[model samples]
Target: MEQSFLAYLRGRTRSLPSVAVGIGDDAAVLDFPINGQPTAVANEPGSGVLQQVACTDQIIDGVDFCSESQPLASIGYKSIAINLSDIAAMGATPTAALVTLALPAHNATEIAGEVYEGILEACGQFGVAIAGGDLSTYDGPLSINVTLLGTVTDPWLRSGAKEGDAIFVTGSLGGSLAGRHLRPIPRIELATRLRQIATVNAAIDISDGFSLDLDRMLAASRVGAELDIENIPISEAAQEMSQTSGRTPLEHAWSDGEDFELIFTVGESDAIKLEQLSADELTTAITRVGTVVGRTGLWKRVPGSKLQRVFPQGYVHGETDE
Candidate 1:
């Protein structure tokens, strides 16, 4: 339903010439020309032009979190962290953020201050400044919206993957609802280091499930993927969640949402280089989970079984399949 609504919105919208990427990806990339010159020159240094990447996200009480149970500070931190994850996916340097809040009518002032404390904490950690935003009171659940802005020389887009490219993911996955969801560590520094090392063909943050987000990237790239089940990193949180969830840790790792880790594709040579990088160089571990294929859907291979089709499954707003 989210996809369907996005499709509808896409059909009705018309992109401007400055818009390099308008919709259907992690963020929108827009070209900002300097000194009345086109910034389309390839490999030109000191061109005084940059692509501005922008993305916005909203979190509401009762849906994203329960205000009564969860700490407001965590909620505020998460609002900024999630947007930073989007910027990380684009391999961009985050600059500033505009945050809007809809506070509850009762105790609105105190709640707003607590939320801002969390927001400011995250912003300071990331070197981002609070640009500007609006605030208001509402009878409905509290809602916080953040619009993040970043700059990139050449944005890593989702449509650049090629057949035979290797699929890589940073950090472990799954069981985000086990308290990891509120404090996401955005891969901004790691993504910057990766840009310095290898050429990322396509990239996306696993905000939804791994399978679902990978499927989105594959669809954008017009390619398919074949994942090695054994290679996928299942987190300890996933293992803990599996005990009573009646599901395998691998299953949770594959389908859980809000992992906030990056899933990117690279050529074979780059993949080899990345795999050879030492822990000190990477700071964070990256796993080669799969490979891009010429087909048009997702497939997975177990150790002893043939490749089998895997449907994209994850959290979708306004819908429930759990």
Candidate 2:
């Protein structure tokens, strides 16, 4: 259901009809092909996708996020955070956001205020402005839809990754289940910095866990990946959580979704420069894990063994009755 909705939204486009020219030189009318530019073509400087980072996100009540034991502010922040992640994945800076809300329960004005405040805090963090939005009441879980506008020239797409590209990640992966989901750090800042130093051929946000998100990139780029398990970074909290769940550290490190970390590709040479510049100090540590292989699928290295595709498909969120 989620996939279908996304597909419909993606194909939605407003168009204006063009005039048909009269047959001129040879009994044939020529209409030059106008290639569809990146999704950011509609954006303008200082406003929307002046470059190529157009973002949109939706949060349903019982599913996308829970209202129980969660503050309204956190919910609002998360609503924007997910959209910002998309912008960051494109290596773009978010400039504007439009938030729409559907409120089912009759809550106090204070709750609404707190939610707005949370959204405002997120906007302040990323230099984004709340342009405008809509509000409506429904008979279901509360839902928030945020569309973030960003800009980046020569924007990175999941399809740009070619064989031999080195796989690099910004910040520690996983550990998000340890309260990281409430306010997961969008990789926008890191992505912007990476653009200056790394010749990032392809990239993505580790929102759906390393396994699935990587698959998204794979599908887009039409290639597979090879990850060196020993090299992937692990956070202390994630390690502990893994033990608690009777799982391996690698499982927590690789499968914990909502890390909000950047997993991007860079040429071998620029990867070094990116490493040096990032060593100074980062909100999160960057790590190099693997490479793009001619083999067309994702894989992980076994201890003292061969690299093999292991991790299964990552998280899928929607109205499924799981």
Candidate 3:
């Protein structure tokens, strides 16, 4: 097996497809639209509407998730779904996706099409189109990266959260190990509806669990939060599956990572309207489990400590000292 393969192909050749002008230059001219933008976009007035936000997530053969033993189709669908969920988190509607893949020689034929079908099916159900993407070979573990573009009248972000805001999360958390991880619902429409009724300060998709993601939100807004662990939504599915753990199934919803729900904060100004809209628009319950407070700093309401204890356990970014 090839240990590492990352290089650039630099040259123009007769072998190039007519659709591709030159990839080795400042930019690769393609026969297709990038991010679903039309060649005529420059002519559009008022800067073409932001059709969507583009994001990418990867699942490598030995990292991010499981090894190749996982079902090829599920692996494929999930690769695309993970990125789409980001669009959904911000209340954005995905209109298209681009899928790029790399794999060991033996893994290509076995997984590529199955993955594309996953991408295509997700696009169909979610009302997105497949514009185009690049396919290639590598000498390493399989890696699938999907770049998704979505459109929302207003795209939500983590910087909007503010002090005195109400923090709410949709749907139950935890028990993903029971299978929610393999297939989780994208809260796209719910987010769109939320945008209409709720004046959001900030928003983030819960890919890395609530605590870590929320930490980012709070940090961005320069605020601290107080969470009522009892009020946190725990999935009935998670409770049924837990064997032994003191952190409570709620912790998984709180910090397990990859639940893919949206963790957004709204000010009290819109609380009542949100309640009314949520009733008509959501299948899952949206609960305001806490509030943003003065910069007493980032903390969780863990028992035994003061009512507001610091949460230092959110996901941290680091591997080890080289």
Candidate 4:
């Protein structure tokens, strides 16, 4: 419903000349002018050409985190990291951020300061600056909204995927709720390295679980995916948690959101190059877990069975767990 509503609104309006991308994908791309003139930079290194990419993410108490259990610094760090993930999904370098905090009237100034410290620490790590933001007192829950701005000469989009492309995911997935959800390193450097070696057909930061986010990429590209269950990388934490949860590690990897890893598709040939390059560079480990197909939904094929349709099982706003 959220995607459909956004699509409807996007279809109703036309993009302006300066708007490289208005809706959909990880972030919106804008061709900002320099000195009051329109500028479109060529996708070349050291070309002084750049386009702006922007995205926002929000988190709230009770829903995103329990303020009582989680440290204020961790909360602030997460708020910024989530937005940076969106920027990184576009294969861009984060430049600045704008934050908005909504807190209860009884909140103390020290808590606010600690949150700012965390935000500052995250921004410093990513080479991003805190440009500006807003603060407001709310009667309800505490919420943090972050808007991140970035720049890329050639931004990767989710709509460019093609049939027969190889699907890849950086790092392992699942069990973020245990600890990683609070402190995740945005794959900004890894994404930049990916673009340097190969042509990434489609890309997205995996926050809404592997299956659901991959479904979004396929939907945008009008393609289908055939996942090899054995190839999906399951993290150590996921494996450990699965022992007590009665769920398989693979299940947790597919359904548990907030992985914050990069899921991208590359041409079959480029996929090979990417593997070799990553190995040589000692970059983040990536696994080829699937392939882009001709059909229009998500699927998985077993060793001996036919393709099986898979529905999204990730977290959804206003939707109860099964």
Task: Give TM per candidate.
Answer: 0.94, 0.82, 0.77, 0.92
lDDT of 3 by residue, 1-322 (tens): 1111111333334454332222211112222355675454322211324433566677786766675456666777778777777777655677777888886788577668777776677777778788888888878877887877765444455655777888888888876756677677777777777766666767777766677677766775677888776888888766776656655676666667667788888878786667666445665568777888876455565557666665634444333211
- Best by TM-score, which number? 1
C-alpha lDDT values of all predictions = 0.90, 0.71, 0.66, 0.85
**Model 2 agreement with the true structure over 1-322: per-residue lDDT tens digits:** 7667656644552243321211110011112234653332332222322333455778877766778878889989998888888778777677788898888757735656778888999999889999999888767778889977765665666767888888887777667867778797888777777766667888788877876777677766788888887888887878878877887777777777888787888888887776676445444568888888778878887778777776544577654221
Instruction: Specify the highest-lDDT model's number.
Output: 1
Report the CA-based lDDT of candidate 2 relative to the real structure: 0.71
How well does candidate 4 score on lDDT at residue 128? Answer: 91
Candidate 3 ranges beyond 4 A from true positions:
1-52, 67-69, 245-247, 277-280, 300-306, 312-314, 317-322
What would you estimate as the lDDT of candidate 1?
0.90
Worst 10 residues of 4 by lDDT: 40-49
Rate residue 2 of model 4 by lDDT.
70
Kindly indicate the candidate among 1 and 3 with the higher lDDT: 1
Pick out the ten consecutive residues of candidate 2 with the lowest summed lDDT. Answer: 21-30
Better model by lDDT: candidate 2 vs candidate 4: 4
The residue ranges of model 1 lying beyond 4 angstroms of the native Cα positions read 15-18, 36-49, 302-305
lDDT of 4 by residue, 1-322 (tens): 6767886878777553437777777998877687987666423322335788899988999989899999999999999999899988888999999999988778556667878888999999989989999998868888899999998876878887899999999889999888998999899888878877888878888888888889888888899998887899999889999999999998999989999999999899998887776443836888999999999998889568789988867876566653
lDDT of 4 at 69: 97
TM match of model 1 to true structure = 0.94
